[model samples]
Target chain A: MSTATPVTAGADTAAVRQAIATTARPPRPGPLSTALTFGWRGMLKVKHVPEQLLDVTVTPVMFLLMFTYLFGGAIAGSTSAYLDYTLPGLLVMSVLFTTVYSGVSLNTDLTKGVVDRFRSLPIWRPAPLLGSLLGDSVRYVIAGTVIIVVGVALGYRPDAGVTGALGALALVVVFSFGLSWVFSVLGLLLRSPNAVMNAGFMGIFPLTFLSNVFVDPATLPGPLEAFVNVNPISILATACRSLMDGTPDGEAITTSLVVAAALAAIFLPITTRLYRSR
Target chain B: MTTHAPLAIEVTGLEKSFGDTHAVAGVDLAVPEGSIYGVLGPNGAGKTTVIRMLATLIPPDAGTARVLGHDIRTEGDAVRSLVSLTGQLASVDEELTGRENLILLGRLLGLSRSASRTRADELLEAFGISEAAARLVKHYSGGMRRRLDIAASIVVTPRLMFLDEPTTGLDPRSRGQVWEIARALQAGGTTILLCTQYLEEADQLADGIAVIDRGKVIAEGTPGQLKASVGTGGLKVRLLDPGQRGDAAGILERAVGAVVLDADPAALSVSSADASRAADGVSALARAGLGIAEFSLGQPSLDEVFLALTGHLAEERDATLEEQSS
Candidate 1:
């Protein structure tokens, strides 16, 4: 009804003048605060478009159910045992899959012109990128939680109990955070959101499957085994699996942290540079 | 072109090119502080490019600019701190509610959480968007989104604001509202660099105008000075009967200077440089028994001003731009 009325009906010229002339600008926000603000924006997007959240939520749930029920007997000879085996790997899988959306969302923001607003702001340059990833971390957490919850409901339990489960979730979230910077670069380089999505998955989807997310590397042929042995996802899954078992695989965990740190170190600056130039 | 007022934006030989296209080919401009300066051009005339550079969103290929005494090249952060740009496209987040968009900007600009909410509400009320503040911006009409975009820019009230084609695709009433908002901002001592393709938009809102063509400033002055430099206005007439328009054109040409026929068969116009002669042309039509529907003597439209300056219509790309009533 307000829209149907004349545009002027809503705008009182005197009030507009008063507001513009009277409002005092506050001091500029700090980098962390600005980034947190963008995180808030990401959360707002989730609130408005629940479908984006649903995309992350349902896809991982679907993956968990299909893998445990369909491939359980063939892969591990028991649904419950396979669930125990794959849930940690699937946790890594689900969370990594959600990282691609970081690029997709960044691409969306770029194409929509909102990035112009963010760029023009006097705040820290990497705030939006960092903040949105902070928001995507929520999606990662949700996906991980859902996978574990569904795994528990299906008669699978982590050998290391709640601490193991929580530790695994924390490790996956950190890795996802680092991996998201890679997609953020893609988002900046690509022209469209769809293009970014396709390219991101094109690289990530295969890398995900070729690793030991759904299958153990030992079952594969020698050449494939070597590839899977070096795959970072397999390394990350190994860390998650060990952490979930309360065994604490130091080599795998250290490798995953170093890989996460290395990815962030390599890609974060590139994403920032491309974001400025683009 | 010298004025006592301090300049808010000063540019010298600013240039930027995108691959083969020279989007901004060495444009220079001086915008006096506290006044609304319009960069008038057609679409793809590099108006957006110029604004983007001035806002420090993009670096210029080969020129220098100073906004509020800080150089855009060397002191970009300082320049950015003093200005805001509402892009040609609505820059507010579509997925966020209008209130959220403003609040987000406020918080980013460093307001406390409660202060951000308060300021957002105040802006929502002032811009007449309070009713729709809770609705996501994606659901907003073009007019509402434009309003919110402007509102977002002023949340921190920069010393200068770059409004790039602020009312491009809006209806006339929405356009008027935007004009009102621009004027209010100017009145509040915020110098506005308004970029627009609409000739009349510059004429109506700009205190001084730079007429850019093919990425160059072909003409620059106050609206009156720009119009005066192009000579005087024309005499536009609408004949009651389409049949009498031909006869009326003949009489008007004899009485006035040059006569150009309008697209309407019942309409024709005379390019008269003086008020007395334009009146005489109207009288001549009366004497010829040509019934007149309506007539007016006024300053030259910016189209004529543009044509005089550039030897081409302002809206040269798409002919439909000429049909828009100023």
Candidate 2:
């Protein structure tokens, strides 16, 4: 074929030269911008691999349906009444459960070569960690909204209505954001994504279940009840329940916020340190 | 020997260790600006470790390196701003499309929304990955992923580029394409630090090569000087008549230093350090009235040089390293 040219011909060489000849580099991006860009990457991952959403979305929906139907009448004398009590708790459970994936995805990034690319860039060090948690907050919102919508469809009605539900979701999202830092630490410390996944679920499962999400702390033994009352998940769930009940518990809300803040304070630095050293 | 040639990378007494396995012992390198400097080594020869330390991905236990005149440790921000790394594995995000990967990097590099998209498209087109730009990178072939990886690195036209085994797992055609791209980058004045295990790759593209073994540079020179250091240029002759090979071997040993008969029975090769001696051996064969079907003289390949320097074949160490690492 006369049309064929040499591999390193004029066209290819010219193109490569033009691509890499720019002497002027754009000013380095600020930490917030780089973090947001990484968040965009996380969102794109969700868009491409929608299956990852099944854990956060479908699992919670299943829990909402199964818990309400299986023990609704036995626990609260009726399914509709049980939905009112369990809906807010389920929102907290769903969102917190979704936080585990933040670690899974972070570990996945570490295993892949892409983390090296990100590390070598001139961007902020914690941008990937913070930005991915930001993206995962979206997943938390999805999980919370799905459970609330599904509960409402199953005859749940909050005393404070839509505004109350939205407030509760915001609170739950903030808590999940803090909790995600713990998993980000796990993701960095662990060697494999599967190990991070297993460890994350193992830690989160007991914390969520041992709390008042599925049952009242009053129903447990004295020591178990004490553990449940002190559980941060239980306090968060209490704040969410009060918000949806139109009677905001000031003490419960303050404690949950403080606990979430403390998690961020302690784990964020640890996660960043592990990320840098690993 | 341009004494004043500005070095793109200057490493001194660089050291790193992973527990007991001293990945990089004391080593040094001076890479000239705009040159393709090859770090030729087998697997686990501390090649990746050295590049990682220089790229600021990991800290060295002891050492100081200046990349583009900025200290890799203290002035890391400056070095990062001017350089990029294409790691041993394709470093682009696998979940994102080819276009998205470039756009993401462009955005991270401070381009505006529209500008990042424009630059991404330009790179996708330049790298000949425009057709698969919309497809997820996980679906791309090895060559396409490598091109996209390189495109992502140059989103802002880095002053220095670190290519860690860029053609490691690629097919021959893809490897050639990568070499072409690398040469084109060099033409545009990008100083490339290429790491590879394949001797031919270094021989083909490296203007200067550092032969690294056991976490240290055993030798550093142009490919010619390295081959010459081994001191054996082979002269192989294939005869028309198999019976004359015995007489030819005697003539070659007399003129050259040593001769080894080939398995083909009609062929024999002589090892000579001097080009004049090789030519004299050829003439001596002709004078003896021995039939000479064909004969050629060439320097010892880098494979031979690596073996003579390391006491083991490059591939032999590679197999052991691969097994241990995996």
Candidate 3:
């Protein structure tokens, strides 16, 4: 069978003219608009797979009840004192757990080629990363609020007023947000979601457990005590507890904020670099 | 459509290497504004690499490329603003519905809420997926997902669009649908750079064709120019009598002073430097009292052009399972 010539100079010229006439001018939104767009999309994704929020909602409440009742008497000789000691640790734990999901979601999006699509688009470089971090903060805040409310109901009264409690909560969220940058970087560098999840959990687990999260650092051996005393999460948790319980002023809050900010400074650029390289 | 300046897409000495493998060799291309230029090649010939560089996804090792008067290296943000890319596979989120995917892209492109919704609806209808707009993209068929992927790229109304093997896994019908969409995009005055392995696709859509092999461009021209570049045409002659094939071959060879290949007693294939020589051979055969049952002379097909230029068959490369296994 013979094939006809598909190209005609006149038709081609006309088509090209039409294409030029119809093409729209490109949009140039500022960084704030770009970040908001990314944040909005991340919120939409959270809305779709809401079962993902179960851990943040269910885990904190369960841990609050289990830890305070099961080990309170043995560890502190009384439930109320133990509840006072353990609430800060549980809050930190809840934030850590919720932040790990951010890594998992990032890994999933990368593997699924959604990140690649975003890379191909003409958006701000930090939009997706910043958006996901901000989006997961919703989960963190919800979990933190639920745990705090439940702690108050269970006789764990905050000696600090509403302002101090709010400050403590904000510190926890800011620290968790910083931690997310590290995990998002890990997710990008790792090959699989499970690998990222395992690595993230492994990294955060020791940092949380080795700290004075469950008990005072003084009760530990000298070497472990030194490590726990210096751990950033432990410092933050101590600071959080101090703010919530009106304990004596210490270097924990300032030290934790400085360390958290330093970690974010180091990791945020590394993650952005990795994302661009990919 | 004439302009004093060169074109929207202009490249020279473009090169990229992945570790030790030279993915894209020194290559040059030019596309008149709004023209659909197709890069036709088999896999691993640097089509994707070329597209990546053009799209500003990856920096080329060495080369100069400009799109819409913006240098890919220095003016990457400007180039990125003007263009959009849709890769071979679907890039839409499976967890999101078709409409959600479209709206997300639109929002990222800085469309207002009402404008994003309006554009999303327009694209869904254009791609014939309006009914499936509310359905999760994971439930979409392969064709539907591909269509949605393309629609997502168009949300920004890009001046230039790069489609890398956009129909590789699609069936014939779906391929046709995509072709129609591509043609419509061209009709809208959008410059398109299409990389495809299908020769018919290049022939159907390209204003100019570049044949790349082993990371270098082997040939470039309009389809007719490429065919003419072979500089010779072949004659397929079937003899009236099976035994006459030899006689016809001898007569044709002696008449044109060229070589003739005989496949069977009834068929003879003859090549000549030009159509006039082929006609001369046929006349000589008829004068020698041999009845010519069938005689036709024409320019070569893209397959023959590929073979003549590369000294190997296209089908041979496609049949080898080595690349696929790796």
Candidate 4:
């Protein structure tokens, strides 16, 4: 082969100069852009795997129908009253269940080496973790809306106006977001996806079930009642009920918001630290 | 190779430990700009650990490394911006298509939508993966996935690239294809830092080779220089008849002024300082009424050089593990 002509050499030099100039400038895809990129990719994954949405979509509808007809009359003394009582816990439960998937999703990414690939990139530090958290909120919102809409269809009335109902929904979404951060950290620390799922469920199930979600805490036994009164999930469920029923000034509502904020503050840093260490 | 030009990558006193075992201990190296520097070592010799530290993925326990004039500890983000690392395993997302994987990496590297798409198309074509562009990576062949993994690292046209055993588990043809890509990148002035256990790979590609044993570099030079540094070259003479082998070996040992290793009676091998002395030895042996046999002389191979410096063959490194465990 003949030696390179000046034309080819000139073109090569021009390309190199362009590449150098581009690299010398500040890196593109700033932190916010990188975060959104991760979030968008996660949402795309969810879009492709519609079967993964079965829990969020189908479970809430089934739970609403079963609880209203099967346990409503016996537990709440009447079916109508039971519908009003069970709706708040059902909404919160939907958010809780959705957050468990966040941990499993993160664990799957870690096991499959996807997270390691992200670590090799020149992107923002918290993008992958935060993006997954944000993307999973869509699942919570979808499930929450399905449960509430089914409740409305089955003759459960929300005394709160449209604004209060929306506010109540907003609280569930924010709480779910906060819970995802906690689970995301757990996913990073744990070895297997199943371990993350089981551990998350173990930590969350008691707080969710032992609370005054199914009935009034005042009516419970002594020690159990005291525990229920102090439980954060009880506060959140009570606050959600109050907001939907047009009674938003309860102590439970204030406590729930504070607890949600506190959990978020604690878990966000933990998740970021775990992500950086990995 | 470039007459001691400014180093593209420099590391001094690099050290890392995992719990009780020291992974990397007191290592130093300098890779010249636009040169292919190969760190040759067996598994668990801290090759991956060093690459991870240089890629800014893991913090070193103690040591300072500079890449493209930026410190790895304090200026990690800067080093990350200028360098790209492809790990030992394929790192592409299996769920995404080949085009999508490349585009995602390009976008993350700050390319605009059109630019990312264009770059992705170009890379797919360059790697001969254009036909598989729209197909999901989960369905790609092993070689295709490896190509895409390497292509993802070059999305930003990094000035420095770290390849940690890029051809591991690849077929011979695929390994040759990757070698071509590495050479092309170096020709474009992109500095490459490669780590591999394949002695032939280091011999063929490395401008400067560093042989790392345990946790430290025991030898560093150009391939030929390192081979020469092993001191003695040898000639192997194979006898046509197994019966005459013993007589031939005895005659050769008496004729040559060097050491003779006779493991197989059918083969006579002797180590001498130079080929001229070996020729004299062969003439003396032929005059001694011994049957003439086939003979060939050459410099020591990289494997021989490794054995001379480390006192253990590459294959023998694993055998020692069983002894230690027992």
Q: What is the C-alpha RMSD of each candidate to the true structure, in Å?
A: 4.2, 4.8, 8.0, 6.9
Candidates' lDDT values, in order? 0.86, 0.85, 0.78, 0.77
lDDT of 4 by residue, B117-198 (tens): 8878877776778888989888988778877887887777788899889899988878887787787778767899999988
Q: What's candidate 3's DockQ score? A: 0.20
Model 3 Cα lDDT, one tens digit per residue, B174-200: 888778778878887788999998877
Please report how far candidate 2 places residue B48 from its true position, in Å: 0.8
Number of the candidate with higher DockQ, 3 or 4 = 3
| Candidate 1 vs candidate 4, DockQ winner | 1
Worst 10 residues of 1 chain B by lDDT: B317-326
On residues A22-110, what C-alpha lDDT tens digit does candidate 1 reach at each position?
Answer: 77878888899989998988877777777876787687778789988899888999888888888898888888888999999999988
Relative to the true structure, candidate 2 reaches a TM of 0.88
lDDT of 3 by residue, A170-198 (tens): 88898888888888888887888899889
**Residue A238 CA displacement from its true place in model 1, Å:** 1.4
- Across B150-238, the per-residue lDDT of candidate 1 in tens digits comes to 99999988899999889889999889999999999998899999998776788899999998987799988898887778767878899
Which residue segments of model 1 deviate by more than 4 Å? A1-8, B234-302, B315-326
Q: DockQ of all candidates, in order?
A: 0.48, 0.41, 0.20, 0.19
Top-scoring candidate (TM-score): 1
Lowest summed lDDT over 10 consecutive residues: which window, candidate 3 chain B? B317-326
When 1 and 4 are scored with lDDT, the better candidate is 1
Candidate 4, after superposition: displacement of residue B178 in Å?
1.4
User: So what's the TM-score on candidate 3?
Assistant: 0.80
Candidate 1 to truth, TM: 0.91
Q: Which ten residues in a row have the lowest lDDT in candidate 1 chain A?
A: A1-10
Off by over 4 Å in 4: A1-27, A55-62, A78-80, A150-157, A161-165, B229-306, B313-326
TM-score of the second chain of model 1 compared to its true counterpart: 0.88
